[model samples]
Target: MTISLNKTIAYTKNWKPTFWIALVLGVLLSLLLITLEPFDNSNSFSNKYFILSGYTLCILIPVLLVHPIENYFYTLQTNRWYIINEILYVVSTLFIIFLFSFLYHFYVVSGLSSFTFASIWDFIKDYGVPFIPIVVPLWVYLRSKYGVIEVPLYDKENHKKRTSVTITGNNKSETLTIFESDFVFARAQQNYVDIYFNTESGMQQKTFRSTLSNIMKQLPTAWQVHRSYLVNLDYLTAVEGNARKRFMKISKTEETIPISQIYYRALGKRLSNSPQELQN
Candidate 1:
């Protein structure tokens, strides 16, 4: 499931110093471009401040939009595998910046008539031409942000919170909202994960199409018992069975949770030090 920044907390959680650094660079570069007039095009003394304002807007607009996109992009980057997420984030954001720049050129700077494909290409190129020399330093500064902490600062001790996690069913539009604690366990069934949780009536389940490994890291209180199952540590009642086949059971749910040989010992150690409060 793809998660996005919903509020200011999410923004602060995802943002880094590098973003502010990028904005500062954007401002300084705008100033430099306005002062030097590198290309030496027809610009008299009277129009200097006007040219400065245009350059400042051009940098500020894209910088503003790109950073927010980065907030969501980093969420994807944290949840998914690096190679896949990086490619998607980069390509998507580049297009976003281009689209923003295009609109800025059309509606703000030049008229809609001058906003053809050729003009847009020329406009982006004009922006890039000045950026070529400083690109390396910008890359070096921004690269550090790629590995920024996704852990939210709000709950310093425990990142876990009662959050609304949406589960989209077979149909893309069909969805259900479940509280984090109510969710019990998930099992991999073919191309989807069959998620099980508790309700006032009884235990309910929903099918979510996603890799188990990906979802494993996403759930804060969940732990993998077998290759197929991820159980909530909060609901876990006791570990049962013998050396041949160890299994775990949860409160109010009699469903047999198998503890495979791989995760068997690790599960024991984890539960050993687990807070007794959750066991209540």
Candidate 2:
């Protein structure tokens, strides 16, 4: 019990810790129940054993129900089936545990010719209480840490067509035709985004809507290194880190975009861990 509780508390810092903990506890408790000699020579149900049995049910049943139901609520649509799902998880877990307990109890009775429900239940009550709350903190911590909430894009029109936007500067209104493929990088400045792309002549610049958050979705899977900037993961050539700052160098571009310190670790991890890049 002590070991299970301690591991649960510590492991809750990461995702799915309770699930791992519960599996271990279930096996350990079952083994202990099976091996320990029952003291029910009198063949009478005792309060001590009753409590233990209740606890055994508590440990496995709630965890099974909680994990699946929690995942259902978190990912899938919350329908009337949610309550039913919870019930099913609990019942299924209990049914399985009970089957094992029944088989082991029968083996014990057959082996020793002495066994009672009280003794079996006692072992259960003692082991199950500590495991229930372990699920909560584990779920909460994991959800908070890794679940990035994404805002759904409101796609009103199915615009299969691609066109160009003209950039009007102080002197001339240069009409630039940009194929979505040729465009490399873009940054928002107030209501305008200075777009950088390779042209026939050389590199060309243009200004367009600053609300590229929607447009960005149309682009490839790129990491938003900073609030103001998003860079193509493939284009990222080298990551430079100093005492206080970090920057990423994009291919075919000399300008090094600054990456926020908060995202440095994540960016570095992604760069080092993920494949070279899967170009869509």
Candidate 3:
């Protein structure tokens, strides 16, 4: 839990911490419920507080369980029903929350009272409506304190599209093929295209007698940022400076790609400064 407090997890690192946090949240919620007085008008203030705490425990239990399940959701293999796993997580969480709400009302508030969907729905609304003002700040604080490095839940096959492109020479014999993800950027250099790409060691370049336009057809993550330069948006980090001049920075490189006034506006509109430039 300490290792990933900022990021959402199923449970806290220790039972003590979980108990303490839950107690604090539960006390605050009890206060809120006391303020609202959304219970049987016949119940006294003391009884109302007691009843609200039971409902609060129900909310906390499901929250603790759901976060951990969601945290590990990205590990599901894409070929083996990733979408189904995601759906199950959501459905199961909702079911648990609703079940707990109904049970709390049945056992504690009203003995075998006629439980209806409307009653459970009202409980859900009261429980979840304060999420923005309450939970969002808590979420941000946890993330800032624990360094919540969010792992994107994109399908493995979708995130890294491993495509093989066959590059052919004028002679029928010579050919070279490359994966699209490795490509960084390409520049139009005289008659040949200077293809810059990422490597295990560092940035590497290859000269191919190919037009930038032709090479771009194979690169889905690439965009024509300038007349001379085509940038692979996947590795792109930021665009700095004013409209007069701008610098485009890519991941793992101190050097910045120049964006000309000719293409600066277009590049700004088409690509974001974030690394997930190709993300939908």
Candidate 4:
């Protein structure tokens, strides 16, 4: 269905996981190459292990180098990530590794004199075609292990119901009581927390001399999406950017609060299960 096709799935742009995945894949592929003795590698002057190491580098280097470029494009289409995008990423990564493998064969496995258009075509049929069957399953496994699913938003009539809540500070008289639904977000600025909320007149801010954690205690419904920011899920409008970098937009505010990677998945789950719809 069109709805299923358009549904967004989580995409991780964090380099730490990417590095580990590439390293593990490289090691596995190297081991396979050693076991199968694929290609006429015995004829080469280099040691078998040494040539295998070159192939490992061919896989590792391309993934590390190409990921940043992929991340750049992912950021441009942040919340729109779908299965098709992930498929493109996998295909592009394989193509890059294929090119690197071709170069490795041309310089290390075969001499410069052997280079020819037909040689490249032969390499594809001999090497690239076989690589896909092995690599595609690995990619599929990695994606299923790491990917997050988005939940459908359902209507809730009481989402905007106002309930009076009081928030206090470290010092006496530094206190505020407002309708919970009107609270937008709070930012920790050194010793003070700047609270933004909606008012009959417009948006208003109240500075409380308290730590973010202390403020969070009073506002149980609020979530700390970043180290310095606490947001009311009721006001959350959209989440933008990939897993590496993300921002949260609040209703009635122009400022976009940064969402830390540590809290990204939790936030996604919270929004996905929330009574209100999360606008992309």
The lDDT for every candidate, in the order shown, is 0.58, 0.48, 0.57, 0.73
Q: Whole-model lDDT, candidate 1?
A: 0.58
Query: Which 10 consecutive residues of model 4 have the lowest summed lDDT?
Result: 149-158
**Prediction 3 global C-alpha lDDT:** 0.57
lDDT of 1 by residue, 118-196 (tens): 8778766876455645643564446433443222212213424567676664567646677777778999887688888
Looking at model 1, the pairs that clash are none
Estimated TM-score for each candidate = 0.41, 0.40, 0.42, 0.53
- How far residue 146's Cα lies from its native spot in candidate 1, in Å, is 9.9
Better of 1 and 3 by lDDT: 1
Candidate 2 per-residue C-alpha lDDT over 38-150 given as tens digits, one digit per residue, 9 for 90 to 100: 43542443443443343344345556655654555434421111224434444555545554554444454334555577756654454333333544354345433443322
Clashing pairs in 4: none
Tens digit per residue, CA lDDT, model 4, 1-280: 2333323456656787777778778877778777777777455646778777668887789889988887786665532355667778788888788778888878876656557778777887887888678877986677556654322233344446778899999899988899877788999998899998878998899999988767876775566677688887667788899857899887788899998775677668766676566522
Q: Give me the candidate number with maximum lDDT.
A: 4
State the lDDT at 160 in candidate 2: 24
Between candidates 3 and 4, the one scoring higher on TM-score is 4
> Taking the tens digit of each residue's C-alpha lDDT, what string does model 3 give over 122-224?
7667655444376435533442343222222223355387786665533455345667776778887765777777667877877777666555555544566
On TM-score, the candidate that comes out on top is 4
List residue ranges in candidate 2 displaced over 4 A: 1-141, 146-181, 273-280
